[model samples]
Target: MKEIRQQKKQPEVIRKRILEQATILVSQKGISGVSIQNIATAVGITKGGVFHHFPNKKNLIEEMFNQIILDLDQTVEYLIKRDQTEYGKFTRAYIHSSFIHQIDGVVSAWSALSMTMITEPTFNKIWMEWLKNRLSQHAETDSHPDLELLRLAADGLWLQSITGVIDDEQCSKLEDDLLNRTYLT
Candidate 1:
């Protein structure tokens, strides 16, 4: 029974490795520069193995996008729970997750994957749906104009950080400014 469980777990391990390697590759080369062959080579698996898990490159990308959204949602939820004030809990969480949060001491995958996914029409729909859902869920606490502006400013910082246009000091200051604004009446 233990051996059977190990055998079942092995495939899952490979699948996760493929996703990790794919994210690393995307961070380095952008989506257009990476392919199934590249991912398979990085993961030490065959093309067929990747197909066995993800069917096609688009499928893999979609999975990656879904994972990023899930991670962001979890982070926002955690931050919201930790916040003492209700005025801008959601917007504050959004700004904090976008700006200060890191995964495993590196920038979150959202910074890299988003730049590529943002250009895809389907991916845009996915992102919009996520934003709409989160906004509606937090309508009571985060509906103020200042909070909206803060969220938008956070988005600008997100773009700048991903593009390397903003230095760390500037980004931190802007992030703090945005977070503080979220509390305005």
Candidate 2:
């Protein structure tokens, strides 16, 4: 029984390693630049071993996106758990979370890789759904343009950071100033 438990962990560990390596590769090279062999080589696994975890590159990309969505959900949950009763607090929390991800050792890779994935049609549905859900949650009686704008601003900041147009420190200050001006009383 113990051996079985330990064996089960091996596959999970390998899968996670593959995903992490994939993220790094995807960030360094665009999604179009990654291949199964590249991911396998990075993870120190055989190409067949990579296929054992993901049947194809497309499958691997989809799984990568799924993992990103899970990370995003965690971020949203963290934001919701904070002081969010104010009208614009949710929006501010969201921008704050974006900065957190950029600086978070565990999540920074995802944030970086996500900028690449964001342009892919395969990942569009996942992101659109998330955006719609969040907007709905904070929509009040009518749609809130201010809240949506904050969300867009956060996305812009993340993209700028990922693309090296701005560093995290600059992005943080910009986000802070945006939040300070935009947060409703």
Candidate 3:
């Protein structure tokens, strides 16, 4: 009965499930490796059902990228609002978002986002615009090279975790190092 109830969800709820399953599939295999059939199978839906949500693979990828950016923005906002100190908020925000997102599977869909960023104009534009805006947001740290380095720490940790170069233990330790060195003190 529970399984029947679960399978009888609305189209929109099922669509969200498809997107999440697609993201997990994308994380394991690059964009090219994920087919509509794979997403449908993961979501326990028909290929036609998947297409009902996303017209095609490119459209799915585009939606995934946008969802990633939205999630990142929310993470940053959460960290900034928590600190309320106005000092090193950007650094903490970046570190926190990167570490949490990586560990908590929020960025699973973005494992190979670089390919999208480099090959897709809209992805590149939105990413660059976000970076530029974030830089401006931390005006106080604009002249400080350490802040710049902190940004790299976030990116490096993200890549290392996403690419499976480091285990979770090492990733957590590195995340701690970035926090202790940058803001936690």
Candidate 4:
């Protein structure tokens, strides 16, 4: 019985360690470049140990994407609590927070996954479904027609910032304009 209990706990411990190391590697090297051995070394474990938790690289990438989804959900909830209006909440949370920089690692992971999915239809469907679900929440049926456009614009700005195409001052101005167009009018 004790052996079984220990076995059950082992997976959780291994998974936690993998996630921690994976997050760091993804952040520093981006997803395409991160290797199982790199993660294992970072966590002081063997490659087989990392594989024990996640059977393959794709599984690890998917888990990282799931974490990003969860993080976004939590941030949305936080925004909802602060602002009663959906548009207000979304705009404020998206524009003001450093989500672009904060989620860069996850974004990089997704980018890599996206490239692979181009040839694999199954993965593409799942990825789109996940994205639609996340967007749909903020785009509840009652939301204004412009809500989708606003969301797209915010996403573009975020992408730009992450790619180093936009400066801090530019982001600030863009945020102001987005707020004005979205709510101030």
Query: Which structure among the candidates has the greatest lDDT?
Result: 1
22-47 per-residue lDDT for model 2 (tens digits): 77767667688888999998788899
Give candidate 4 regions above 4 Å deviation. Answer: 1-14, 23-31, 86-88, 91-124, 138-142
Separately for all candidates shown, the number of backbone clashes (residues 3 or more apart, or on different chains) is 0, 0, 0, 0
Q: Tell me the tens digit of each residue's lDDT in model 4 across 45-134.
A: 899988888889879867865665466557656766787555555555544443443533444433333334543345567667865765
Query: Which residue pairs in model 1 clash with each other?
Result: none
Model 2, TM vs. native: 0.81
Q: How high is the CA lDDT of each candidate model?
A: 0.81, 0.72, 0.74, 0.63
Ranking by lDDT: 1, 3, 2, 4
Please give the distance, in angstroms, between residue 31's alpha carbon in candidate 4 and its true position after superposition. Answer: 4.2
Each prediction's RMSD to truth:
3.6, 4.1, 3.8, 5.7
Report the Cα lDDT for candidate 3: 0.74
Q: Which rank order by TM-score, best down to worst?
A: 1, 3, 2, 4
Candidate 2 — which pairs collide?
Answer: none
**What TM-score does structure 3 among the candidates reach?**
0.82
User: How big is the positional error of residue 159 in model 4, measured in Å on the Cα after superposition?
Assistant: 2.2
- Give the clashing residue pairs of candidate 3, or none: none
lDDT by residue (tens digit), candidate 1, 10-46: 8888988787777766665767777999999978889
Location of the lowest summed lDDT over 10 successive residues in candidate 1:
1-10
Comparing 2 with 4 on TM-score, the higher-scoring candidate is 2
Number of the top TM-score candidate: 1
